[model samples]
Target: MLNLFSRNKQLLDEEIINWIFDSYDWAFKQFDPSVFFEETELVLPTNQYFPGEQNSINGMANLIFEQVKQHAGMTHWPTKLLNVTESEHQPVNPATLSVKGQLRGKQAQASFELGSSVEALSEDTKPTETKPAVTKATSTKTTSIKNNAFDESEYSTDLNLVMSAGHASEPNTGNNSINFSFHPQQLNSPEGLIAHFAQGLAQHLVSAAENPPPGGKEYLPVATELMGIFMGFGVIFANSAVVPRQGGCGGCGGGQSPVRQVVLNQDEATYALALFCCLKGIEKKQVVKHLKKHLRGLFKLALKDCERRLKQESRLSLSFAS
Candidate 1:
């Protein structure tokens, strides 16, 4: 998965991370995913700052930015705009406060503020209690998933797809889980998954916006996997859904836009889907013990934020049934 998500292609800015959590918070309030599966359109309360849109999930990238800005309370955030405040805050020397230096400093600070939330989350998720050693069963599962190689060939056209619901309690007094998996494929590799990222995002977003995929009898389990991949660490799951891809940067990059270069070919999208299935198991793995402290902060903030959202919502049956 690290190989798939790959190198430093711009860090997920702090604000974007916050928005992701907020989206989770919103979904949690409606029910940890009942609403996600039930409704195609996502809406949020309107306020002076971030008035979420009627179709927040699948809108044109530019328009969504306005909604995100409003929600982040950073509507005044600059776009191709600059301010003067050289590196030292107060220019190292009054004479050094040239327009260029001042602008650079301000720009740096502005960018820092933008990513504050992500850093905060990273800090908060840091480990507190020491984690127990990985049990043999857990280690075995990890090895099996990673060692399974993809079927790469000219004739390998079919994806090995499986979807089924867990057996319900015979008494009908318990819930069941859904499981879906695909035979490992080339696209699940570092090179292939990276190649399909852009196209997969375009397809997913467009499908979500213009025409949602048919659900039929397979909806619940499939939807659960999608939500988990998206909400969890998102290594294999960070679809174009990335804020920058949504045009969140202050200014557009020059030269041919990457979006224009990639043709949204169906083959590529299909490949990505296969990879998504193989990567779906990432959600269940526990964080590595050594790195748990670093991630604890993120877990903490996400929980705190969800709790806030839950508080705003009416109490659900489970909360008060006792």
Candidate 2:
């Protein structure tokens, strides 16, 4: 179980909450109140460690499921979850599960392209890969300071490896001049977390479009209501983590210490990138195109894995009932 120690756990929880509020604030700014208030309620799952007993991953999942069902016109919930047969005592790591599933509702039948980078969109000309120059200053009288160039190549290599594994790229999709890159590093960094939350917002959008809940037009307002929740909370988390604040320094019993609290490590960035990719729409044609260019066999294997998981789940549930 994840431990909540010192103020770290509390801070992380607050950060997550702030992200939700920031999302809401942004929506209200645009004159959208549906998110803040809606008579209808949807059940969704939350993280297991969420404060209230009511707030859990299962709860959040249920909430999202209900919203999607209402939008999709699903009269009942998908109670038949893929029984996580894996050991609970062990550290929770979904990726480790050799088991994979492809529920009919969650299957990716479409393809998507990456948006251009923000820099690319703003600048008239495309950015050419340029190396940063490094210089060392030598002074006998003073400490010799070496202005070492940032190892951008190292960063690029790591980012490239992940992109290659995930098989995502910024292929201009249309007139949607949105340019963005899911840098694994950024997910942990100030910008990365914003991007991460944005990815969640994107996921909500994709989920809404792909899996609308049981309700018809009645829940549209509520679904969109979440937009503000996402924006408001996102901004707060980003600003609070990035903007430097002064506090008492340890060295001087009472001295000014400048510090930026939130930091995004590499792992977080990779997760964020995955989220971004998940949000991107995949067209059937694009999938076929990719198959033609890449290892067609592995693509089939991945799909087969999805099919096998769904079948296995169905079988397990049936066995339990019998």
Clashes within 3 Å, all models in order? 16, 59
Deviating ranges (above 4 Å) for candidate 1: 1-206, 210-293, 314-322
| Candidate 2 residue-wise lDDT, 1-322, digit = tens | 7565743222124343233233333323332233223211211111221111122222322233233333222222112111122223211111111101211122112222222222221100111121111111121011111111112321111111111122222223344222222222321232222323333233223232323422433433333324312322221222222221234221123211112112332222112211111122222233322111222233333333323433454422221211
Model 1 over residues 1-322: C-alpha lDDT tens digits?
A: 3675645232234444343333333324422233223221211111222222222111212233333323222233232110111122210111110111111111122211121111110000111111111111101000012211122221111221121233311111111110001112321332222222222222222222212222422332233223323322132222211112232331232121222122212222222222222222212123212111223234333433334434454432223112
Q: Give me the displacement of residue 184 in model 2, in angstroms.
A: 4.8
Candidate 2 Cα misplacement greater than 4 A, ranges: 1-29, 39-172, 181-184, 188-191, 195-322
lDDT of 1 at 182: 12
Estimate candidate 1's RMSD in Å: 25.1
TM-score, each model?
Answer: 0.22, 0.21
Compared with the true structure, model 1 gives a TM-score of: 0.22
Give the C-alpha miss distance for residue 316 in model 1, angstroms.
10
The root-mean-square deviation over C-alpha atoms between each candidate and the true structure, in angstroms, is 25.1, 24.8
Candidate 1, residue 316: the lDDT equals 29
